[model samples]
Target: MKFSKAEIDAVIAASPRTNLPLSKLVLSEERQVRPQGSTPKLSVAELAASIKDSGVLQNLIVVKGARGLYEVCAGGRRLEALTVLAQADDIPENYPVPVLIVPTDKALIASLAENVFHIPMHPADEYAAFARLIGAGKSVEDVAAAFGVTPLVVKRRMKLAAVSPRLMAQFREGQIGLDCLMVLASCDDHVRQEQVWNGMPSWNRRPAYLGQLLTQGEIESDTDPVARYVTLKAYEKAGGTLRRDLFSDDDKKAYLLDTALLESLATAKLQKKAQQIAAQGWKWVEVRARYVFEEFVKFGELRKTRRAPSGEEAAAIASLQSRLETLRARMDALQDHEGDDDNDDREFLKLDAEGEPLEAQLKALQESLCVWPPELMTQAGCVVFVGSKGTAEVKCGLVRPDDRNGVAEVARKASEVDGDGESLVSLPSAKTRPVHSEKLTRRLTAHRVAAVQAELTVRPDVALVALTAQLAHSIFRDDARGYHRPETVFAITAADCQSDLPTAAEDLQARILDVVTEAVDANAASPLAALKKADAANGAEQTVAATGWLPACLRTRREAGMATEETLQDAPERAASEALAA
Candidate 1:
């Protein structure tokens, strides 16, 4: 088992030999560029030129496979580049290249170690190389140390490499900065990644702007990635601006107080108007009933029809009466002559005269009956009656045996009032009876009022106005802490004082007033304590804890607010609360 150094060297030299052509040996194998693999050991242009001018830079390393074949351990690109050069007439047609034969396992290990340790590559390239090593079963610590970086850095780089190739290209081209790319890499959704990518402008100029646009677009876009990207680009081209007007401390305080008072007045007015309308409805019903009754009385007297006969009928009746009178006169003269004769003759004459009288009476009766009977007039009474007088009297108490005189008097009154002799009467009656029970009426009224109040409270426009007012008041109160003035606060109550109030007049006023009161009360306390309390009340805890409020995020940003009491109070706690709520 033991051997001297000379013996060992002699054994290694005499171990094995191969007759494989160097060209075949180099061309037969393929090598993988590491995952964290750099751009290349050489640039594509440099390698192409080198191959065209001379040949492959270094011998291709290979491992012996089954039979007489070989597998590439490293230097795959060099071989390919040389082959390409040969085919293009840039290199010799049958070029011979160097080769290094090694064991398969050792060749693979060598390829990984060389990629992991030797080059200074981009993070993406390094990550790819590390991944290749790990894929080949290398440990993370080994890979980290080999690259002279921390394990965390190694992991992060690997993650960066794992991002879509399209994103990595964006990074290299500077269409998106490293921070933005890191954010994109952290996200798991492909749609979001694509959105961020497509939202970016071309990398030639304003890369940071493109990144910002992409971030904003992602925030505003809906679930669809393509749609979001398209919308963001369109919005930018359409000239969108994200601008805010910051108020001074004094201005904010004045706004809050005025808003609160205005809102209270508006609410009170609305309640009063609702009450008035309800009262008006009740008054309208009573007035309408009285008017109806008066109208019926004025028009009731004209409803009877006339009973006079036509001229022709009257003339015919008169002629018949004249004929009958003449006949009666002739019969009387004949009867006087017959009385001078025999008793039988006298009796006969008398009978004739009597019969003539009967004829005259019949003719007179016919004359009297010429016109149709007059229609009976309708009468107004407590109860309207239909049927025979006796039946009507019994059912409706129109008349009783003891009150016969009263019935006669009513009949007389009816006949005088109605020109025709009609007995029908219509009396005024209450149209609306008192049927609304006290409890039910009260409940209904209460419900109606409540509904009105609820409707006012829940109107979206109103709510929006209120929220705006409240926000303005909050801003104002914070600004006006120690030097608060009632007039300044009340200024917001005026029509044009607080410009930030929501456009909806009523609700905005109400909400603004409420916020003003709250702000004033808060400001009245110890300024620092009030701010702390406000911050706590505003749900700043979560935001502060997360360190992700907009104020905190922008505190060190280029466009931070000017130093002031309000800005100072907007530290982690307050800013967080506001951001989370927002």
Candidate 2:
């Protein structure tokens, strides 16, 4: 019975196998190679589940025990699992177990051999085997039950199995790793999988890149704003397709295929909301999937004015406010007394329930007082679009650039009227078009240009300064301003100007000239530019600005009155007698 290593293999080969009833088998003390309670409880539970699903698979090595019971020297865990199953009534008390009977002397050696020499199946092989079982007509749930794992685990393994054959071959050869294979498995198209793998450079074949490339052109249901707006269920209901990635932890990590459908749905919903707003008598209403600030910044927005609330509305607002205050006070008192006492807690909950609705009613009543005049609504427009957080957005009282002049005229008339009186001149509706045709516009601009050119010849200083500024702006502009062409005629450039001016001197000098010219002329430039430069000047700029002198081009206005000691003492009088005598 004390055999050398050479004889152990022959003994294993010659062992006799038989079935023994669970009631007649016992775990042997000789099988205590592993420390007592060393096995994890989860592993024991899984083993029990597996045994219950499809009786014990491998045979246990046993020896004759002290009475009629057979002692299991090897596979003590299997014995424990069978006992657990029998106790739980999952299996009958006398369920049969497979065993290999060995001599009493060799029982310890058999136990050691079973524990130490056994190698677990490779992970790749296990996944592949699961795929094969599924392919052999077994359901995912069935396979999971057989293996004592959840269906999700089985699904993940099956997803891995669905990888391109070429990639799988590379995985087996240890060329491609399991992580990269998982990403490839996320894409159901095998051709796409192989193409992605072959297209990637050797150094760039990573899981993250692989995942990104695989799901390119597909919208993510969870993270994408459009998809979140439309909702995954809505997209699917509209006959859209989704590609799932089982390896990802997020349950919503699926890609939506029909992006056009989502966009159409969003546009349609926006249009419906826009129609309701348009009924409020706006001149024009437009809808867009997204709101781009640059596209709409040039439009003028109407000023919002408030009207006094009516008598009934005012009374309701006061009542709601009072009720909200009372509810809050009561809730606060209840909170002060809240403790182990259930009555105080219940009262606090009841009072808290009334607070939100009353506050909401008061807020709604207050906001209802803000309104745009009916005349202004006719001049301005509205825009409806989707916001970045996937909700509908509305922008109202927007006046188009062409309509700003008309709207300003109406506002001026309104200001002149006293006590909400009607305007003396009737305002034109937004539907009115300009009376001048294209031909008339061309003729008018041509005449204006001729007069401007004639005036420019007499004012050489104005022409020179205009030419210099235009040339400087064109030469020293950033890439963001590259699209704007300088609207000037003289393209002056020479080494003489460059020699006279330092590279950095022109920028500061030009800005100073601009500020002085603007202050003298008092002509309003862009409102945005004025705001940006309002507080931008420092002490040096202020010192330069005190000169009060400007180039001829910017000094287009002429002052009729002179500021001298004589004029300060007495008002200047027009000499009318000389013309009357002629």
Candidate 3:
């Protein structure tokens, strides 16, 4: 490759620097107007907000225009932002805007050089810098303010920074995706992260699946039954840990890391309830953290009758009910607690204390109202268990099949006749399925998807290409070839790789392409290799072999992309050429 003397002359043209009022700077007429799906320009409002947050950190390149005015050749967004402030009177018309004044003839060169021949900062570097700032005693808010970003943005960077270095390397090498990295960052266990990655076949490593694998045993704090059963306060008191995702729009996006501890706390509460039930002359009381209706199918339940409390007990119950009503009124008046957790907790505790005696007395009276047959009681016992969401439930009068007696059978028959009519076991349905004829589609796709996902995860090399592609496409599509494109697809831009590359050492893209080529070249035993080999139409195509990672679907659409079309008067090069030559 060679550069013309004109380009060298443009390079050598020295640009002088100067400062001017914001109002005096204007957009350059010479600024190249690119079509959509080409170079993307920053919107005025967005640049204005950024400028308002952090004053211009870099200078715009400008050239002398008509009437002694300066036209911005580069940093058009910065110029536009300053113009907006000037229009709104947020800043004085004479407010200083840094500018690098270049020769009028060289203005286009300056703009071209700035827009082209440039690379974006690596995401890893950005994350590390943010982490460093926080590590240096700057609070997240402080760091956000310093960088002109939101606090949540700063936190996201911190999370990204927290990702395992090993995983991040895979990302740089196109082995994993940015979304996957983000999910992995949510879990701090590096060893666990790598293990999950390794366990996943190359086809199934999607961000969602990766998140599932990373957070498998963990529970969502908002939805976990245990979280609801034991108040967050109690769980925290018991040394359970919670992780919150600041990046998430939802305020309740907190996850419980210690599921074991949550179950332990729930068990302890159930154990106390079980102790009280044991005193009721039951043969045995089984306590479990959770209960499933199906597990008790073989255990027959006994019926119990309820009896009214004594006069004195009735009076006490009436008093407790009145107290509870008043408390409930106070709770309603508070209108959703509205950040008053302490008051809510205190009121709940008070209600619990007041209800305890009433509950016990009521239970005793209920037992007196009904009695199981003596013969049935002798053979059967009850199981005490915690229900979903952490409430204690009793399955009383359970008679094991082994303990069933002739008298118990008669009683069971009578109860069945009076019970709600529902089958104890489920039956299979004989309905036809949809046109789709498949099974475990999800599991099967994972193996095909993992490699693609890993390969297209974010990277610094094709960042601009991705950005340009995104902006060039409609707003409805993902920016350029990012996120949505199959990992095996390469949306290569010819405009890239145009640096002062006297050698490949300075060309990052060259080295990366080389790595990809070698890696795919060595994977001769890949799953798709056989399919590509059998494709007579494109089997000899380079793209099919180059993307050994891509499954058949992603590898080709029509003819192989790498196949060369027949061209010359082919001493039979093409069919037409062959006919003509003959």
Clashes of each: 25, 0, 10
Tens-digit lDDT string for candidate 2 (91-164): 88788898998988777888888787789876678888999999999999998887778899999998988887
Q: Tell me model 1's lDDT, rounded to 2 decimals.
A: 0.44
Candidate 3 lowest-lDDT run of ten: 565-574
Question: Can you rank all candidates by TM-score, best first?
Answer: 2, 3, 1
> Model 3 lDDT vs. the true structure?
0.61
> Which lDDT value does model 1 have at 43?
57
Which number leads on TM-score? 2
TM-score of every candidate? 0.21, 0.62, 0.51
Q: What TM-score does structure 3 among the candidates reach? A: 0.51
Local distance difference test scores for all models: 0.44, 0.71, 0.61
lDDT of 3 by residue, 491-535 (tens): 221121112212222213222333334445534323334442234
lDDT of 1 by residue, 1-582 (tens): 333556434433543434334345443334544432344644544566645545554666677766666666666666666666666776564566666565554565446544555556575676677778778986767666554455666666666667778878777786657766665655445676777567655563343443354344232223232223223334334444321111111211111112223323333433443354334221111111011233334221212233444586467656656665666676566676644657656666666666676576656655555431122111111221112221111011122223334444555575778666664322333245333445544544454334334544645554454455456546655554523332222111111112121122212222332333344443432333434344433332322223222211222222232344433333322222232223
Model 1: lDDT of residue 17: 35
